[model samples]
Target: MSSERAAVSALFLLNGLLVGGWSPRIPALMERLGIAESRAGLLVLCLGLGSITVMPLFGAMTARAGSRSAVWLAAWLTAPSLLWISLAPGFWSVAAAVFLFGGTMGGMDVAMNANAVAVERSRARAIMSSCHGFWSLGGVIGAGLGGIVLELAGELGQGLAVTAVFAAGLVWAGPRLLRDPPAPDQPRAPLRLPRSPLPFLLGIVALASMIPEGAILDWAAVYLQKEMGAPLSVAGWGFAGCAATMAVLRFAGDGLRNRFGAVRTMRISALTAMSGLAVAGFAPSAGVAIAGFALAGIGIANLMPIALSAAGNLPGMAAGVGLSVVTMMGYSGILLAPAAIGWLAESFSLGAIYLGLALLLLVPLAMSRLAAAADFGSDTAP
Candidate 1:
């Protein structure tokens, strides 16, 4: 179990590392292609489309093959796909590569979360938050280190380094992942949409939580670099700062949820995140904006994990099915935000978009009760 947990954690980290490594390069990618923010956003949208397209199929695959196989398959595909983005010379080529990256990433996201649910169920405890914490930790390393490497090695070098590290991690974690036998009753279809309001509502909560997160991941550096006059080399730290605090709080989130109950924890988290966004949106300087992002991280850290836990435990639904539905819905925020925010930012300001996103938190805050389902196995659930 311990080895399995470690392996899952490593998978989460590697997944995050890939994203983190990519986040810092968005500005450079835009520069290389000589594209406007709107065009870059459309390119980013391709990523979300790819992910959304593949998620349901991956969900079914996870159900039919067991999560370990799904994880390995996605991981193998995901690692090398980064090179496609790094090397693509034109807009169409980059879009195609990003779509492939998003597809693989979406597959891995579903598989790994399913694996985390299995691990949590076996222990009859909450480790989902901690697993995500390792992801944030990886983001910190990826963004922080990636920025340095980008300055020294350029885009291709950074891509190679990230891919190499991910491959090495895969080699180490592959055999250690927990392998569950495929259930005879598992769904074999390529896609299965949610039939219940429960998954949709949970997905809404997850979506609300993830939009800002995706914004931060995809745009925070650009926000810092273009708006605040931060150097390109250091702009990545905006997200690095956010992921740092997110990692810390997420490591502690399971305990908070176990003790305070998921509902109360969610309420507080929503408020904190809202406040953080407001701060960032209104901040006069980059440093303050970074601090605000960190604060937002504290609030945003455990939201999707808790929602995912609830989805996994939904009555009458298979874990993979429920996870896939909610995962696809939640990730839609990532899909939607880049293009929307790009258009909106082109019209208004990025700060305005951040401010607007802060208000969107009310939806999740009002729906906090839904998170109570996350406490399915907890003795301290309220």
Candidate 2:
């Protein structure tokens, strides 16, 4: 790899690590502050709010600031938010921190994907999944280490302090690895509405596919604990298992695509997901349910990366536009679905909510063939 490619890849790796490290510490923060569980769940909304509200603006930002500058800003902002999360005492202060965290993460996500799209063009190959693979590895390491830190110190502030240091170090290294960005390829103008109908529809597909992942993140533990009688420690492993499977599958997806083609790969993945969720909702035993979650992970592994790869390859549109739309929709599922799941869980059984996630994914599964055939940037199906 070129030094620039190496540099950007390193940044992607670090991004995954930091995001992973932050997750396990969240419960400690909630306990430290005496916040209610529902309130804490609501706080997650702020992060999504930060990410979602500003996403469409990113293509414009890329035009104005260049991708590297945008990444630098995110790195600089992210550390302080981690620090704030550690220090904040009341609800609103922490809420502000969550908002900033989400916003910074949002910008970083868009910028990194933009960088990947650009870098892939320069390389003339599909390697986006590899970058995301590192992200999955980072999450694994971060979550594991965060568990250790929480156990050792029982202080969320200390954990954030550590995160801030690592984040700063990554930021310092970010500028070194950045590739020279292209000249502004589009005119700077009003952020007009998205012109492409297909990107928008694909975005819908992305959103529907992502809801199951969100459920695994936010509600898996609850279902395990409330419904299955698992201990707190074991309950978390529900999501951990799913994430681990996703990381591995995603890391291997490039090869999978190379072997099977994106379309067949997506169809197989969707089938795996649908079956996984069905098994998960009806899992009579804890072990069975966890397996189902892992299956879902394996199924979900490549959809986004493949979708983004396709979008980036679209003939008439800028890769940035296709990516931004697809990304926003995917993130919307992450941002918007947990609460809806919670409502369903309250009104119906947790099983019903999870099963609903499975049902929703069926739409994309049925349409996966359509998604495969549409001109997304390559001759490959799906």
Candidate 3:
């Protein structure tokens, strides 16, 4: 409702648009590059690698320059880099382009989230979930528009170029609508990684949550199409259902957390994740799998945002630095999920991966108490 809220929401949308716009076209990109499926997977890994490597550095930069300047710089870097990656002429070039693109995305992610934390603190209540809701909405828009562009123009490059332009336009308009943080010239303590173990606990919770989330994103369609004999056209419904549910629920997450508190929310959500993935893993029909994926989306939707909020607000640390550490660890889980699942799929089954990740969600369930205590510092968990 505030200008800072509007600006931060816009940036969240921009990030989602850029990332989702390119995602639907990945198969085409690999085909263009004459790369095998395995190699394409590796290239995706490179993107995550780039993001993880640079997140902490960007966090420090955000600390020094304030999230305002850091976000603007990220916008500038992201647009052109996305365009370049879309038009890459070869596999290696695509790899390099995606690395840069991922770095900028990572930078934007930290800066924008840091900004969101500031905005939330200014409001003195919960709003992070709503901010993330806008991101989910943007992903829906980007994916739908990207799919349309593919149909109309028959070139992923053109769609991505258009997305890049839109992202740049948003960047140009952002400062006008958004409130700025303190000036970069303001004297502040230099950024440092957290020394306390609390952030690590938060990061572990985030890592556990992200593995299943990423697995659903990267493999849901594959599981439906290949394992269940669903039509290729319909296989995407698994992810679509998940995304739709996630969007809706995240908009409501703050209210739930406010009413029930983080610990109970975490516990219920993790149990939902476990059940949903288990259902999907053992599903006999594509419809059931899609439904399961939707449930899983509901479960996983708010955990990352909640973890991030907890991280940024951790006592006795700079917000940006604390956020970056958790983000890096979470991204590691995301990066590991797809590649590790793929490897396991060679010998085991995608269903096995789903079930494995489902079991892993318990780690967060176990850690939810820690998250509650760290953030609220109360026995509000039960």
The number of the candidate with the highest TM-score is 1
Off by over 4 Å in 2: 25-37, 155-158, 161-165, 168-173, 180-183, 229-232, 284-287, 369-382
The global C-alpha lDDT for each of the candidates, from Candidate 1 onward, is 0.89, 0.69, 0.73
Clashing pairs counted in every model: 0, 7, 0
Candidate 3 Cα errors over 4 Å, as ranges: 34-36, 144-148, 155-158, 161-165, 176-191, 229-233, 373-382
What's the CA RMSD for each of the models?
1.8, 3.2, 3.4
Those runs of model 1 whose alpha carbons end farther than 4 Å from true positions after fitting are: 187-191, 377-382
Candidate 3 has a TM-score of: 0.89
Q: Candidate 1: global Cα-lDDT? A: 0.89
In order of appearance, the predictions have TM-scores of 0.97, 0.87, 0.89
User: Which candidate do you rate higher for lDDT, 1 or 2?
Assistant: 1
Q: Candidate 3: lDDT of 73? A: 81
Model 1 worst lDDT run, 10 consecutive residues: 373-382
Which 10 consecutive positions of candidate 2 have the poorest summed lDDT?
373-382
